[model samples]
Target: MRVRLDYGKVGLEVEFPDHNTKAVLGLKPTVPLENPTKAIAHALRQPIATPALADIARGRRDACIVLCDITRPVPNRLLLPPILETLHRSGIPKERVTLLIATGTHRPNWGDELEALVGGDIAGSYRVVNHDSKSLSAHRFMGTSPNGVPIWIDKVYTDADLRITVGLIEPHFMAGFSGGRKLIMPGVAAFYTIQRWHCPRFLEHPLATNGSVRGNPVHEEALAIAKCVRPDFIVDVILDEANRTTGVFAGDLEQAWLTGVEFAGKHVRAAITEPVDIVVTTCAGYPLDLTFYQTVKGMVGALPAVKQGGTIIIASECAEGVGSPDFAQALWETSDLEAFVRYISQPDVFVPEEWQVEELAKVVRHAEVICVAGGISAEKLTNCFVTPAESVEEGLRMALAKHGESASIYVIPRGPYVIPTLC
Candidate 1:
């Protein structure tokens, strides 16, 4: 059987034995909204749990709208126009309205990339800016959370008369579901605040994995930080496999987000009768698979569907190579997974990008990982504690050699976009 995996700008097609294949897991297809613009307008007007956006923007002078960075495939062009128009209709002028890119700890997006993020018109006309998490001076101290995580948000967002976040609601590997409060906490949070939140106290928690929100420390900490900022409103959307807006969620932060999460949980989850001996996955292509650091999500997402000693073969474009300098350095220094785990597990030791490595460790501990990343060299992947494969076919051949030809194989084409759960 031939399956086209979400890979790079185009995608990769690999053939697997039909007899050995257990199931091909992916998101349950949903019909796109007939009129996305109308749906978005309706969602903003009759928003869940809170007053309409126009009412919230009424009398407000300055407004700041937060958006996820380029890594997330959010329909910014479609989602922003209606929002800006509503804000303008409610008395907020274009000059007073700022579009803040919630970069989290990632690097800033500029020039053509900036234009691609928000439409060219908005990028040129509006005061669009990137969030710099490393700059302490740029952030306003919002106080500390119950878990002792400091809350420091972008000054531009906090100083605004109206605070809003525009995001895509998807199944996040750590926070259960993405969007809503996430765009506030780690999205525009300060360096120290994000560091504390990504520490083992949250990442190592049992509930921090994908498709889990109740009692999730990561989710709780993010919610706590977002509460401190008191965002006025939010517009989050759910996209289908083609990245078209399927559902629009807008209104009260907690209420609307929970509603979206409930909706996503039902559609994004794929059930398996039992774990398989080998799993093949991807990092969902393009911007998401641009770096090896982001590729870890594909590995972690496939863990639940693979047996303890099974092999996971992940194909990622990683067009931008490894990741941030800090993350690359961490990968180079990590020769032994156990020792690396021990080091990061220490209370005093906290690395800037170790949380991703920590998540990668969870997968390596349970199953062997073989990476098919064209952008990264084999040596670099080996340094990162993963076996590098020239292609998915080569990786499959290697895995089959180890697991036997009769071993059951499960393929997840969209990677983290589909959560594999045991029935």
Candidate 2:
């Protein structure tokens, strides 16, 4: 049997013996919108719980549109132009409108990447900039959320008379789902605010896992912070396995996002007959798999699909390396698994990418992770307590060697995009 996994700009294909493969779980295929542009225009005009976008932009002069960074597959090129045109038609000048890349703690999007993110027309016509989470002077503290997260956001976004966020809604490892309020929390909030919410205590919550937000502290805190900013409008999309927009949610931030979350939950969540001995997954591909930091999501997403003490083989390009300096050092400083946990769990431990390590530790606690990638060195994988393999075949062979030939194998080509929950 052969399965193709998304890798980098292209994709990777793997073949396994018919008897060795159990299933290849992915998002339930959904029909893409016939015309996503038309859908966006329709959504903006008839949105959930809010007036038409033109009405909302009627009297506003300065507008800041927050967009997802490179890690997400938001199809900003298709999504942004219509929104910008709507703003322009409403009399809001393009110069007065700013396109802010909500990169969170990630690096800036520039040049070709920036042009691709918002398209050449939008990128060149408007004032495009990236949010600097570490620039202490750039963030303005908006006071603390009731949930205790200090609400500090990019001054550019807060100062704007009209604040709008555009992103894709999908299952997130820690936040239950991504989009909506997420565009504001880690997206543009100050480093301290992001660090505090991503603190070990919040991430370790049982409800913090995928498809659950009722009691997820990370989701709740982020919503609180978003409320503090009170973005005037939000546009979030739900994509199918093919990265095509399946549904569009626009208008009021909370209502529209919740609507999109409900839509995403139905398609992304999959039921498995039982836990498998060996699980193979990817970090989606391209933009998302560009860094090791993003690779953890694939690990966490596959954790529940693997039996306790079972092996999980993850393949990601990790083209951007570990994606974070502090995360890399944290992994390297620790001697072994025990030290890794002990070091990160320290009372005063506070680092930018520390949450990724904690999430990885949780994955390590439940199952063994083997990484197969050419971009990230084997030494670096070892430092992070993950075994390294040069290819998927080699990794699967290693896993089968330990678990035996009969070990049930489950493959998730899109990784975190599909939630595999054991029945």
Per-residue lDDT of candidate 1, residues 151-250 (tens digit): 8899999999999999989988899989999999899999888988998778888889888999999998899889989789988999999998889999
Model 1 error, position 271 (Å): 1.1
Lowest lDDT block of 10, candidate 1: 332-341
lDDT tens digits, residues 292-380, model 2? 88999999999889999999999999998987787788777766655655665677677557788888888998999999877988988
Cα-based lDDT for every prediction: 0.92, 0.89
**Candidate 2 regions with alpha-carbon error over 4 angstroms:** 337-348
Alpha-carbon runs more than 4 Å astray in model 1: none
State the number of backbone clashes in model 2: 0
